[model samples]
Target: MSTVKQLIPHDQALLVTGSLNAMEDDRGHDDRSLIHPVQIVLDGDVINCSCFDSLGELGVSALVVVQKDPLVTYITTGADLIELSIENDGSAQVRRIEIPALKDVHEMSLLDGVLWLANTGYDEAVAIDLDEKCVVKRIVLGKFRGKIRASLPSFTGNDIQAVDRYHCNQVFQDINGKLCALVHHTSGKQLLKRIARKVIKSQGDGGVVDLDTGQAVSLSLKGPHSVRCVNGDYWVCDSGSRMLNVYDATWRLKNRLPTHGWGRGADFSKHHGLYYVGISAERKRYRDRPDYNDRNLIEVFKTDDGELLGEIPIVDGIEQINNVYLLQRGVVETLLGLKLSSWV
Candidate 1:
């Protein structure tokens, strides 16, 4: 068994989000009763788990730590954005905001108080105002009449159509402070062709697109998930190929580190010179496959040399890891606050 000390410092903790295997529905539909919403915290040798049953089966996907002073965290389900506020006195509050027309929200980032979400189901990226708690802009990624719209005017759920052509799963801010997307398909033309043929497949040809420039900065990726800019370098999770691809400041390929599983959620700890990457089990589509029971874990790597340091196994009931975030032990203890006793 791998120990947490091998993965991170004793004063650091990791926040993980995923689906519980036993609570998942066999049919793949979002059944509220079958969904178990929980937050898993790995601190020291203790695994702290908290269940938010009141969230009503929204199904957790991606999350971001938006604030540190008050310790605020935002989580996304397909249908809602849940905000968690932790007070210094060890009390926490939860708020759920309804976001219509959001489908398969995979990853999100916060910039200038606006939360940007990769709305995968609708083939668009959405910007939600943190203060107003509402969507402020929608950047359409799919082709309408063979052309991609710069932005959609509609805001309601029923106003737009669901195409999911590009499978835009992760949204982040580049090193130059530009908003970008990690799409599962290479180009708009390829996506349109697949839609026309009714054959949707995730090939190892996805790329990163600059939302502002309307151009692809990097290409030829396999099922990419998380993209993080660290000290001017771009580190991407090439999940489809089970590798972590690093790029220089010029977006040139620098290194490819093997993750040994389906790479998805990831975060970096500059304080420790390490990278925490989530390696999840293959999805339910591969239920009968030989690797279906593969171990789910967080692989730690040395950022300086791209060395595989160690891994922290995700045990208990969680089967799928959607995101992994590193936090200081002080902030984590404050977030858990009064709830730590009941959770641990």
Candidate 2:
């Protein structure tokens, strides 16, 4: 007789996915080394999983769930983009969309049928027209901040076109539909220096930038990677600092939750009144740290009191995680080709 693991029944669940081994080198900038990207659906402590053979490799760095006919979900490899159309029976069909302007697509947001992607390779966030299937506009972080692109002659290319300048990796849209961006460094020179050393320090220089009004807001962050506006509050993954930074609608720093491992992705479950956070284990970058052996884990916390609830550890197969999303109860599974049952 086979043993079946039992877990607490939960209505809402979190879907955590990532680029396996993406963060092993180059501060996770080198996509070529990433592979075997996987997605795991967590219900309480039990889980169901699937891989990304049909979706393209080098690890899925960004994801967004769309509620529509057939229930669509979008994912990216920081370069290529794909979407899955899922049916009610938990089966899905994947489609790849090739856009020349899509370079190093990272954390993404969908608003009004338009997909806003963090084009980290180009140092800008690009707005892709879903209907037209083309890049409608590129919001250059430096230019959007009302600053000129750095023109240092020593560099092989212009600072604006340099890969990971500002390391602008996440895009967020406000309640009014205004676009905002999160970047690593505000100064091009400083960004270059950090790149040369291949180190992302707690510089407190990284923050949120208002792409429309050319405004910048610093929240004393360090290597901040993910940004989102949740329930009238701005939530950020201060990755380098290993903390979840929350800001009020007025942009004031509200609450900070110290996290385990490298904090990158987060999602709040409105129905469950809980917050799920992705905690990636320390890699070669933090080689000297003692927590290197720890596995990549997703932690749950009570939204009302910030109390620790439980943890879903990703053991075996997956190496690094980039994002976690809440799939409320009945959304279709985004991944296909798995033998696991939907209720597992």
Candidate 3:
């Protein structure tokens, strides 16, 4: 059996992509550079990447892993145009969820064993009942639910691996159960029209649809991207336009963080009272440069007053020299393959 690098992170399941580079000088196994290997069952399987953005030796050119559960891990190739799903037992499943009218399937959240997504179309998400192995429900989160079959088109590229350009949907649930979906707000719209848009997104403010009646309780506000639930309240990471909008369990706007940027992901490690936020500097510049970024570093801060701590560089180790490992017996026998190392 391959030596599965164990020291997994606190939110190991949420990790979408990662790598295993050789920090020291040891070139035993070193050629899989471009493939965005999302899931690594063993340590290293097969790296046939088309990694664009950067080149050379992968500081992290091993696997792109995203996990939500110990048993459930989703990993995709850098540019192979196909995502991979691997089980902890080293078992594998391949899929390209080709649903008509799909945009982008952003990071997912599992609540009560149900997967919730966000988007501008119907139901907002495609809920999969893992046990049942079927789509139990599709959240139609728009005013044009029954009528709008497909989500509005996006303004991005489909060059990334496994991304069909259709799975780009988003979803957010407030502590009070408010489900706010993102929308394309064109600039310079009439005042009444803007009001109408607000009313439509206010569907699930005081708690989502009635479990008994299937009715939506309209809230007065909308939630931005990236939200974390704490003590039944939501601390939203409004990354877009550089803002941190706060809301109550009822989806009411409470406050906003003056300090903000294009936040890709966030985690509050109460262990150290540290809030680690991942950001891409490119968001501010080259706004027109379309490829979804992978260059920004991580921002560290305190949870209490949101004081600035420091920045952890998320550099693509395509050129790292110490992360090393090998493929043996179905495991990424990384000295930290796939990204861990012997020192750990």
For each of the candidates, the C-alpha root-mean-square deviation to the true structure, in angstroms, is: 6.8, 6.3, 12.7
Ranking by lDDT: 1, 2, 3
Write out the backbone clash pairs for model 1: none
Residue 252 shift from truth in candidate 2, angstroms:
1.5
The reply for model 2, stretches above 4 Å from the true place, is 1-9, 23-36, 44-48, 87-93, 145-164, 188-202, 290-293, 332-344
Measured by TM-score, how close is model 3 to the native structure?
0.51
Cα lDDT of model 1 by residue, 1-344, tens digit: 34676677777788776664433443344545543444445544535444443342444677778888788888776556788878766577777777888777888888777899999888788999988989899988753323333221222322233334577887777777778788876455333223443433435557777776667643577678888887679898888788999999788999999877889889998877899898977656567866454677888888899988788877644557788888778766665443522211
| Decoy 1 TM-score against native | 0.81
The C-alpha local distance difference test score for the whole of candidate 1 amounts to 0.71
lDDT, each prediction: 0.71, 0.65, 0.37
TM-scores, one per candidate: 0.81, 0.79, 0.51
* Worst lDDT 10-window in candidate 1: 150-159
lDDT, candidate 2, 1-344, per-residue tens: 11111121255556666665643462434543334455555443434344453343555777787665567877787887777667766666667777676676768888778898888887888888876767888877766533623232233333323333566887777656677778776543243324554543325577766777766665657778767667777777887777887788877888888788678788876655667788887776667776553568876666666676777776644567778876655652334333423211
State residue 162's C-alpha deviation in candidate 1, in Å.
15
Instruction: Report the number of the highest-TM-score candidate.
Output: 1
Error of 2 at 278 (Å): 0.5
